[model samples]
Target: MNTTSKSKADTIAKLREKILLMQGFKPAGAMHKRITGLMPVEQAFPNQVFPLGAVHEMISEGPEGAAACGGFLGGLLGTLMADAGICLWISNSRSLFPPALELFGASPHRIIFADLQREKDVLWATEEALKCEGLAAVVTELNNITFAQSRRLQLVVEKSHVTAFIWRKDPVYLSNTTAVARWKIAPAPSISEPGLPGVGFPHWQVELLKVRNGIPGSWEVTWSEGRFHTHDETVRKLVSVRNDVQKTG
Candidate 1:
């Protein structure tokens, strides 16, 4: 490339980084600081990294779907809080079981749960929590959120650099919002070891429905050993068989 072309390219690259930073993502150079267990899934994002300090919307249709979504978020929270960080969870319904978080590697004590009486109260608490730079992340449950409300949350996080996750269980309407990404998580059959007893690890069909400046895709993932794993049927079967043979021998 010519010198003038190279100079222009560098300027454009820097501009893109600045834009992403404003949108709550670190630049390409800082890709190492990303949520773990999101391997190929992260490739769909701009610079192959998930955006922190922004709002992420997750939708679920039924009770089972909501449970799966909560479990998945818990798994991510485990990593986010690995550094002794604190998180706030605001919800009116109080469907999430705080004790269950231990299965996903997050200590229930590290998350402060705000069980409000009204949805508006949940939203209010979420916004306030997002504005707190001392918090690592904020998660709120609501049936719907207006674009303006989401935009305000986005602005708060941009300045505070705190990540926010919005879980909409059985939402009446899915409207346009300022959320950086939209996800849908559904319950999938748990993988069981051969010759073993009852249920196994939690599994989910994870879908990235939409992302700003990124690709949308679907993936089957499981929460095993306290982390997210891109589920592979073949690998599971082989491991199960191998373990069973060893037990028999």
Candidate 2:
């Protein structure tokens, strides 16, 4: 390409980055530096970065699916908490085993879990927690969420820059939400080495059902070596993305 053409391309790229950043996406350059484990999936997002300062919605079929979704979220939490910031988990019917999070690289002490009996209480706590700038992330469980409720959460995160994950446990109807992305996770068979005796690494079939301005696809991801490892059984291509978890001094 000629110099004029090259200059024009660069200008457009820079402008695009600025627009994406304003829309709550990190820059393309930052994606390579900060994203871990899910590079290919992350590329499907605008600006090739995970959407921070926004809410993500996840739905599951039953208890098993819900557990799988939680495990997937655990991996994300590990990365988000790399800076030593605390995470808040609010749920109405909580079944997560906090001790098991060690397998996903999250310290149980860094997570504060609140179990409430009413959905309203869970929503209230979740919204209040998201408003706290000191928090790294917040995960909430709800059977259903309205567009307005999700929109409110999105607005709160935009100002606080805290990520939020909404877990919809067996909702009867899937309605519209203001979430940036919607996901569904199912338990895939575990993988074990030949000499290993116990259950192997946690495997999951992740489906990106809906994303605001990104392509939707499916992949199998495994949590091992303190990071996410993406691979497909049929293709057998293993992609190890950069580890962005903050290192302690």
Candidate 3:
């Protein structure tokens, strides 16, 4: 074959490989399916539970609280994506802290942060990003969002099979809605030794205020070194002290 013909054939082959990856046409079936049967929660979601490929909404009272919630959720989503997919962050007010996020298994490089000015623009851009077949998940921050807009986002996520996370500045009062899960995160107790302490940030208290197919109510979670885990009573006391310091400071 001539040089030009050979080059053309190679290019075509690369294109075909790219197409296959986008379609998830692997030689073997999905690994998740094989192990999911052993997990009850995974069965409940049917569409991949927790932060995997499911639409979730997180609402916080203020920017500081929202940062904690966002970082924790980002890590969860990042851990789910691992090296196989990318996480999109569409923010209007705050920027994602790379070092903090990296602790949760999100690679700073894999995160794509986009700053948008208007609420409508943020929603529009988020919708477009969710439609991308290549992304593992998309997370967006919006100061205001309506039920109708949320429903539209849900439709796009369902169609594309991409997980969407919406973070709002304040609580959204939707009597009836289509969100798969709704979470409210707050500053909880810190996990630290009471007497043997250096200066560090406070931990978090996460509550699953609403979940479509899962149990809801309070869930105590602590954050440290970019990782989130369940908080025990001992850690809870530490967090209480930390909370006091924060309040006084």
Candidate 4:
């Protein structure tokens, strides 16, 4: 064979090897399917496949703020489901506002809100949500979570091929856990037209505090008109305080 032909064959062989490795590295018990495309994050930052078997920690400051974060994450998960799937929201503090969730593109009917009275119950329900294959994703609001509990939840999500979203009231140090990513969500000032008067409802600033296999940094995201989009520089600068908290805390 010619040298050029032999080199082409070698490249093809290497590509096949990489594909095989990816297939094997996928979390066990996950059923592989042909996903058509990913949801849109922004023109600059495209949406990515939701990592299976790994906990995705989304920390927000309060109940209202957590709901905003949960809504965005939940909508992303909802877009991935082939059919309308159950979205389990496990919380001990407050029930999510349906109207606010609608702003994030989540259908109220697809969501199941479970209000627990204690932390133990919240964790137990979160585990159950992770185990349920019928669910597309599970969003949990809690004050505290231990590494051991996170590990258990991760295993369940892997086995069930479900996404687990933990919305914490405050930031907590996580060590010895298999979380793929950790995010801090905060409210950002709304954008306004040059001639327009009066302030508008605020947007959100999403900072990826930690990502196992992706870029980690601040991304200004806003939920408006039933969609999530990246923010402009002015909006991002206005929300510098939230970014500072995520960076320093």
**Candidate achieving the largest lDDT:** 1
Full-model lDDT for every candidate: 0.84, 0.83, 0.67, 0.66
Compose the digit string of candidate 2's lDDT tens values, residues 90-195.
9988899998887786788999999899998988898999999899889998989988888889889888988899999998889999899999999986766545
lDDT per residue, candidate 4, 1-249, as tens digits?
Answer: 699999999999777657634532343234532222222222112124445445778778766676657666755654544366678888888656666655555677778889889999999999987888888778888767888888888778767878788877765654545667787777666555444667655466777777654567776566555445566566556557545754897
Q: Looking at model 3, report the run of 10 residues with the lowest lDDT sum.
A: 33-42
Q: Give candidate 2's error at residue 12 in angstroms.
A: 6.1
- Local error of candidate 2 at residue 211 (angstroms): 1.1
RMSD of 4: 6.8
> Any residue pairs clashing in model 1, and if so which?
none
- Please give, for residues 91-165, the per-residue lDDT of candidate 1 as tens digits: 888788889988987889999988899878888888889989998778899889999999999888888888899
Per-model TM-score versus the true fold: 0.85, 0.84, 0.70, 0.71
Off by over 4 Å in 4: 1-48, 77-82, 172-176, 232-249
lDDT (C-alpha) at residue 130 in model 1: 90
List model 3 lDDT by residue over 182-246, tens digit each.
Answer: 77778753455556677444456666667664566565665555555565566567667778877
Q: What is the lDDT, from 0 to 100, of the residue 181 in candidate 4? A: 75
Task: Return the lDDT, model 4, position 16.
Answer: 65
Output the number of the TM-score-best candidate. 1
Minimal lDDT window, size 10, model 1:
27-36
